[model samples]
Target: MLKKSVTFVKGIGEEKAKDLHNLGIYSIQDLLEYFPFRYEDYRPKDITEIKHEERVTIQGTIQSESVLRFYGKKKSKISTRVLVGNVLLTAVFFNQHYLKTKLVIGSKVTLTGKWDQHRLSITVNECKFGIGEQNSSYEPVYSVGGKITVKGLKKMINSAMEQYGNQIKEILPPYYLQKYKLIERKDALYKLHYPLNFEDAKKARRRMVYEEFLLFQLKMQAIRKFHRENSGGASINYDKENVTLFLERLPFSLTSAQQRVVDEILKDMATPYRMNRLLQGDVGSGKTVVAAICLYAAVTARFQGALMVPTEILAEQHYHSLKALLEPVGITSELLTGSIKGKKRKELLTRLESGELNIIIGTHALIQDEVQFHKLGLVITDEQHRFGVEQRRTLRNKGLNPDVLFMTATPIPRTLAISIFGDMDVSTIDEMPAGRKPIETYWAKHQMLERVLSFVEKELMKGRQAYVICPLIEESDKLDVQNAIDVHAQLQHYFRDYKVGLMHGRLHSSEKEEVMQQFSNNEVQILVSTTVVEVGVNVPNATIMVIYDAERFGLSQLHQLRGRVGRGDAQSYCVLLADPKSDVGKERMKIMTETNNGFELSQRDLELRGPGDFFGSKQSGLPEFKIADMIHDYRALEVARNDATHLVSSEEFWENSEYKYLVMYLEEQGVLNGEKMD
Candidate 1:
C-alpha cells in the first residue's frame, strides 16, 4: 500500500500531477473519481453523407490540400483547405504556422469536430493521420482548462487508471451496494471514463448520483437528530384566546390559508420542543400578519421577542409596521441597527436589557455583544436566505431556548425545500389578501422603450408614482447595456418638472433611506434603482415598474421585482424590456405573463435553471456535488432519503462497525455528534 499518490501512476509525473491539483485532484483516488459531464458518440459518417450543419466524424483520404497565409502589421492568419471528393471545407487556425507542417498534401486522416454551414468549414479539434483505426466509437469529453487538451487528458487518465485502479479501495459496504442495486466502485469508475455504450454510461452515472445524495441525506438527518436531542425544550404555553382577540381587532380578515398557517405555528410554539420553522409565502400574502399574531402571543406571556431583517430598510419598515399594529394594543417596540449611534444606541440597549421593549427589530446590529434581551422568548428572521448559519445561530443563542421562525418572501418548491431545510419545519401561505388585484405583466422589445416611458408618464399625471429598475448601477464602457444611474439622469432630463431620485447598493445608507422615504411620501414622482428595493420597501403609490435588460434577470428575481407594485388599490403594470435575440428570455417572460402565482413560477424556475443558481450564488448554500445533480437526480434523491431515514432509526446499525465508520467521517468534517444515534 503506497498510500496512493497520483504521481506514482504512469504518465503523471511531478509536473502533470501538480497541474491536476489546480482541478482539485491530489491523490490517485481523486483522479479516479473525477467523472465526465458528457460523452460524445461518433457513429462514423461517410464523406458523401456528411451534412454541413451536423456535427459528424468523417474518415477519408485527403485528395488535395493547400495552406494560405496572410500577414499584417500586428497579426497573421493561416488556413488549411482540404478536398474530400466533391466536398470541400476550410480549417482555419489563427496565427498557428505549425499547422502547415502537421497536415500533408495527400494523407488519410479522421476529423472530429463541428461542421459550419455558413463557411462550409470543419473546425477540426482532433485530426490523426495514418492512425484512423485507433479512433473509438465513443469519446469521453472531460472538463478541461485552456491549456489541457481533451486527448491529452484522456491519455493521462487512462494510463493512471491502468496502473493504480486495483489499489483504490471501496468505502461503501457490500450489503449497502446490493440493497441499492449499485455497481461496484471499480467497475463504475472505469466505465464512466470509457463506457462500452450509452446504457453503461447511464448506469455508472446513476450509482455515483445515488452515493452523493446518500451521503448528503445522512449528514442532514444526523444533524437534525442531534439538535432534537440536545436543544433545551421551551416551557412557554400558547394562548388561543389572546391570539383570537388580536386577530379580531385587525382591520381586515385573514384568509383560510393564513388561518391554517397560524394554527401550525401555534401548535409548534405550544410544544415543549424548540421550534425551528420556516414561514414561506408569496409576495403580499399576509405572512407578516400571521407573524404579528405570534409576536403578540409571545409578549402577552411576558416574554421578549426579537425580529431580524436582512437589510436596514426592512428593519425600519418592520419596526414601524409592528409598532402601528402592536402599539394600539399597548405593546412597546424599539428599533436598533448599525446606524443608531451614541446616546440613542445606549438607550435602546438599556431598554432591551430591562425588558422595556417587548419586540425589537434590527439588522446584524442585534447580534452584537453589547445588545442583550431581558427574556427573549421568540426569534423571527426575515429573508432567512440573506443570513448565514453562524449569524442565525448567534441570534438564537441570545435567549434561553427561544422558538425560531424563519420567513422568506421567495416561495421555494416543496422538493427543494425538503433538501435545503430538512432540519426545520416548513409552512407556506398559498393565498393572497382578499382585495389585492394581480398586476398585469407584459414583455416588450427594446424598440418599445418609448411606449413604456409614455405609460409611466401617464401614470405620473394621475398623481401616482412609478419605478424604473436597471440591473447595473453605473454604465460600463465594456457592457453595451443601460445602467440605473444613467437611466436616472436620463429620466431627470425627460421629466424635469417631476422629482426623480436615484438609489443603488453603492450609495450611502442615509442616501438610500432618504430616496426611499421620498418615494414613499410621493415627493419623487419616479424612482430609478437596482434590486435594492426587492425586499421590504412598501410604496403603495408607485404603480409601474419598467425593467430594462429584463433578459439578464431570472424568473424569480423578475417576479420579486414585479411584486414591488400592485400593493395599492390602483391597477398596476410591469413592463419587461428585453432583447429580441434571446429565446430563453422570452420564455421566462411568457411565464410571468401567464400566471401571477409565485409558487408556480418558482417551480417553473427550478425546472428551467435548476436550484444551484436560483438565488444567484449569494443565498443558495448547495454543496459542490461531483456526480449528483439536484434537478436531474430526483429518483436517486428519494432513494437516498429513504435509506438515510432507515439507517438512522435502526438500533442495530448504530452499534455496528458501519455506523462507526460513518461517525468517524462526520467527526473528521467537524460536525456535531450525539448519543441520539446510540
Candidate 2:
C-alpha cells in the first residue's frame, strides 16, 4: 500500500498529483495518514449573546438585505448587510454572485462564521436555509486552501479512505501500543478525520501525537548510536598551562555559569570520542570567550579550528573581536568570507591548508572544498539553526569527526532543547557577565510616539547614537506596520540635525558594512534597521533603541534587540512602541516589561506560542511534526523518548520478530537520512 502512488486514485491527474506532492502526500498511504490540523466546532447560539471575535452559529430571520458590488481585476464581490433577529450584521462573500439568489430577503437561515469586530462584519463560510434539527459533529478543518479547497481535499481523503484505508498496515509494535494505552491505529485515523465528538478527536490526537513523538525519538536514538560508533580523531590536547595563561590574559573574568559551561565543553573535548556540544546563552553572555577557549585548545593540540557564522557581518565582527583577543597572545587567524576574493582569498586558503593559520574564521565559505584545514580538531558554528544537519555534517566531514560546538543566542527551554537538539550535550550560560548593566526597558503606546521621538532626539543630542528598528524593509499593502525605508525617511526629516542610517537584509554586503561602519564610528547618529542587526554589531555608544510594532516580534527577539544597547557603561533604554490587541500580544509586552531572564522568557514563549513561532522552523533544524507539539505533547515526548532509547539500544529488541515494526517505522520515517543501523 505504501508503494502505490497517489495517481492511482481517481481525479488525481499529473497536475493534481504534483500539487499533492508539494503537500507531502506522495502516495495513497500518505493520503490515508494525512490528518486534519484542527476541527471547526460549530454549536448553535442565540443571536442576542454574540460577542466580538467569536465564532458563532445562529438561526434567525433575515429581516432586510442590502448589496454593494466592487469592480476590479477580480470578479465583483457582494457586500450584503442582513438584519438577523435584532442584530444588524454585514456579510461579505467574495466572487460568489450565485449566493445572491440563495440568500433572499426575509429568509430564515442558520449562519456560522467568525465576527471581526473591527470590520463590523462576518464572512459566511457556511449557512443552512432550513429550520431543522441537525446532528452536531466536529468538522475537519485541513490546512488546504486556494487552488485546492478544504472540501476538495476532504473528497480525495474520503475516496482514499474508501479504497485503501482497509489495506493500510500498521507499523507499531502491539505491546508498545498497549503499554502506552494508545487507540488502534486505524481507529485513530478514522476518528481524526471524522470524529463524532470532541472527546473522540482528543483521543485520536493523543494516539497520533504519541506515535509521532515515538518515531522521532527513535530516529534521534539511532543518530546518537551512529555518533558513538563513529569515533573521532584523538582528543585535542588540553594544555593546562596554555589554557590558564589564555584565561588570565582575558580582560574580564568569566562568570560562574560561563566557567561551568566552559568546563563542560573541555570535558567533552578531553574525551576520546568526538565532542558534540551546544553552547546556549543570551546576548552578551560571553559565549564567544568560551568558544575561543575551545578554539585555543584546538590550536594547542597543533590542530586547526574554524568558527563559522551565519552572516558576513557577524563573521566580520567575530573575526575582529577574536583577533583583538588572540593577537596579543601570539595567535594568528585569517578571515575567509565571500567578499575576500582573488589573491587575498587564495593566499588565506593556502595558509589555512598549510597550517600557517591556527584559527580560521568566516561564514559558510569555510565549508567550501578549497578551504581545507591542515588538521582541524574543532568546529564552532554561531547561530546553529541557520545550518541544517547535513550542512553541519559536511563541515564535520571536513576533518576526521572534528569536535563540533554549536552556539545560539536565543534561549531554548531545557525540555525543548532536549527534544530538538538532543544529538549534542547542552550547556547554557544562564547568567550574564558582571558589570553588564541590565537595559532599561519601557513600554509605550502609539499615543506616546512623539514623546519617544523626543527622548531619542535628546539622547542623540548628547552625542550618543540610537537605533530605530522596523519590522519590514519596505512597505506592503498587506501589512500595516512601520517599514525601514519609510521609518528612515521619516526620522531623517524629523531629526534634521542628526544623521540617520539604514540597514536591511536586501542591502549588499559592502552597503551593509558601510552603514554599520558609519553607525559604529558615530558618523550616523540614528540607525534604522530590521532584525538583521539583532546579532552582529557591537555599538557601545548607541544608548537608545526604539522598536516600532514591538508586539510583532517574539519575546526572544525583543530581548535580542534590547541587547544591541546596554553594551556601554552609559545607561541605555529600549522603548517598545506597541498597541497589541490580542491577548498573546499583550502577554508578550507584559513579559518583556517584567523579566530580563532569557531562559524564563524562552520557556514562557514556548508555552504561549508553539516552537515554530518562537523560532523559524528552518532555524531549529528539527523535523516538523504533523501532530506532536513540543509543549502540548510533552509527556508523550518523554515517554516516546524513553521507550525509543531503550528499543534502539537493546540488540534483542531489534532482533525480536515481534518488535520488527520498530525497525520498519524508523525506516519509513527515513530517520537519519536512511543511515544503516546494521
Candidate 3:
C-alpha cells in the first residue's frame, strides 16, 4: 500500500504526479519520506523578547494604512505600522504590492521576518492576515519545482497523510522503538509536516533521522554480510621477514603511522575473509610506498598483484616507483596503461595471464575484459574515490576473490567515513614522514601575481620545478577567472629563459604524459596546468605550487593542489592567487593559509560546501538522506551503525519474527537478494 503511486492523493492527477516525480517521489512512501529541508517558525513572539536579526513571528493589529511606494525599476515596498502590545512596530514587505489592499487599518496580522531592534522594523518574509492558530504558524518548507508551489506540496502531502498515513507500517522492531524511546512512524510523519510547536518538530525529526540512518545502515550491513559469507576470500601467508627486508631496502624508513597501517593491511590479507579495507592518508603521506610493501607481500606469497590508479600518468608514476622498489627483490612488474596498446598490450596481457608478470600496474586498462591473472591475490586501488563503485567492483571481479585494498589521499572526516565506508575496515595514516617540512601557504590577491611569480622564479633558479594551476582550460565567457592556456602563455613569456610546459584536460593522454615526463626530468622548470595534476605526480624537486582563482576550488581541493608541492625535503610553498569577493570564498582562502591539516580542512569544507559539492557531484555515491544529516545527526548514524552491525552478526536476528519486516523490506529493496542471503 505504501508503494502505491502518489496520484492516489486527492487533487493529484497525472500532471501533478509528473511534477512530484521530478522530486524523486514516485510512490506514497516517497512522498512521506520527502521530508522538509527547513521550517519557518511562525509562532508569534513578544516584540520585546525578540532580539535583533532574529527571525520571529509577531502578531499585531494594523495601526496605520499601508503606504505602497515604487522603488528602483519594477520594485516596490509596502510599509505599515502595527501595534504589538505597547510597541508600535513597522513592517516592510518588498515587491509584495498586492499586500497593500490586505493590510487594512485595525485588522490583525501575523508577520514573520527578521526583526531589527534598532529601527523597530520587521523585514517581512511572509504575512498572514489574522491571528492564526499556533499549528498553522509553523510552516514546513519543501524543495519543490515545476508546477508545484510550497502550498501545493503541503496540500498534497496533507491529503496523502489523511488517506494513507494509517497504512505506514513500522519497519523497526518494537523492542528498538522502546529502546530508543522513538515515536511511532505514523506519529513522526504527522508531526514532521504539521507540528503544533517547535518541540514537536524536533522530536519528529529525531525519529525520522534515526529511521533513515538505521535503514541505510541495515542495507550496508546486509551487503557486507552477503559479501563476507558468499565470496570465498583468498588467504595469503604472512611473511614478515620479506616485508622487513623490503622496508630495509628502501632508502627511507616508514613513519609510525605507515607502519601501523601496513600491519593492519597485512593482518587483513592474512585473514580468510576478503580484505575490504580503505587506507585513508593525507596527500604526501606515503600511501604508495605502503601499497608497494603490500604488493610485495602478495607476490612473495606466490600470488599475483595488481595496482590500479585513476590516470595514466599516475599509473606510470607508480610503475616507475614500484619497479625501482620491488624489481631488485625478484618481483617482475609490468606497466599496462591504455596507451600500451596493440602488440605491447598483448604481450603484457600474455605475461599477466601466465603469471610471468608478478605485478601489473595500470589505469582502467587493468580492468579490461582481456586482462586475466594466473593467481590473483591482491588488488590495490590508489585514489579510490575517483572511480565509481561499479568500476572498483569490476576491477575486483577480475580475480578469484582477491583481497581488495582501497587508498585515498582525501582525508574524509570520521562521520563521513562511518556512513559512506561503514562496510569496509578503515585505516588512517595521520602522521607524515619524518624530516618533511610543512608547506608554507599564503593567500594573495590576483594583483600580487608578479610577486608570487618572482618567488617561483627564485625557486626555479635553485633548480627546483614549480606548478602554476588554473581553474579553467581556456577563456570562459561564463566565468571571470584565469585560464590555464592564457596563464601558460603569460608564464611562458614571463619566464623566457626557462622552459614552461602546458597541460590540461584537452591534451591527449600521450601529450599529458610527455609534458609530465619533461617536468619530472626537469626539462620543464614550470608546468602550467589545470587540475589534471591534482592526483598523483611525484617530483621531489617541485617546491612551489601557485594556484590562480583558488577560490573556485573547495577547501579540500585547494588542500589537494597544495599537496602537489611539499613532497620534497626542501621547504615548499603554496600561493593562492585569488581575490575572493564573497565571505565564504575568503574563508576558504583563510582556512587554506591557517592550517595544513587535511582532515580539519575537510570537516570545515563539509560544513561550508556540503557533502554533494565536497564529493564533486551527486553522482559521487554519497547517500542522499532525506532527514538525517551526516554531520548534524552523526550520533544517530553511529547508533544505527552499531545496531546494524549487531543485528547483522546475529544469524538468529535475521530469522526472528520481530525483524521479519526489516528482512522483507531489505529483500524488497534488493539489499539482500534471496540468492545472496541463501
Highest-TM-score candidate: 3
Model 1: per-residue Cα lDDT at residue 108: 69
lDDT of 3: 0.88
Q: For model 3, what is the alpha-carbon lDDT of residue 282?
A: 94
C-alpha lDDT values of all predictions = 0.81, 0.83, 0.88
Tens digit per residue, CA lDDT, model 1, 466-522: 988898999788877789989998999989889999999998888998889888889
- Candidate 2 has an lDDT of 0.83
TM-score of 3: 0.93
| Structural similarity to truth (TM-score) of each candidate | 0.86, 0.77, 0.93
* Descending-lDDT candidate ranking: 3, 2, 1
lDDT of 3 by residue, 1-678 (tens): 889998878888999999899999999889988888888877778877889899999999999988999978999998999999999989999999988888989998888888999999999988888787555767788998898899889888888888998898887888889998999998999999888778889999999899889888888888888878777898899588988888998999899999999999999899888889899999988898998999999988899999999988888889989999998888999998877778888988999999898999989888788988999999999888778777888888888889999899999998898788877888999988877799999999988888988999999889899999999998999999999989988988899999999999998888999999999999999999999998888898999999998989999999988999888779999999998889999999999999999999999999998888888785556888888889878888999999989998898788888998878868887977633321
Residue pairs that clash (backbone atoms under 3 angstroms), model 1 = none
Cα lDDT of model 2 by residue, 1-678, tens digit:
656999998878888888888788899878877888888776666555668888866566655564747687667666666666666778777777777777777787777788777766777767778654445457888887447788889899988888777876666788877887788888899899989889999998998898888878888888777666676456887787999899998998989998899889888887888877888998888888998888887788788888999878788889888888888887789888888899888888888888889998888888788878888899999997787767677788888878889899988887788787766678999998878888888999989999999999888888899999999999999999999999999989999998889999998878998899899889999999999889857999999999999999989899888989988899999999999999999999999988888899988988888777777765655567887788877778888888888988898777888777778776676754546321
Candidate achieving higher lDDT, 1 or 3: 3
Q: Which wins on TM-score, candidate 2 or candidate 3?
A: 3
Between candidates 1 and 2, the one scoring higher on TM-score is: 1
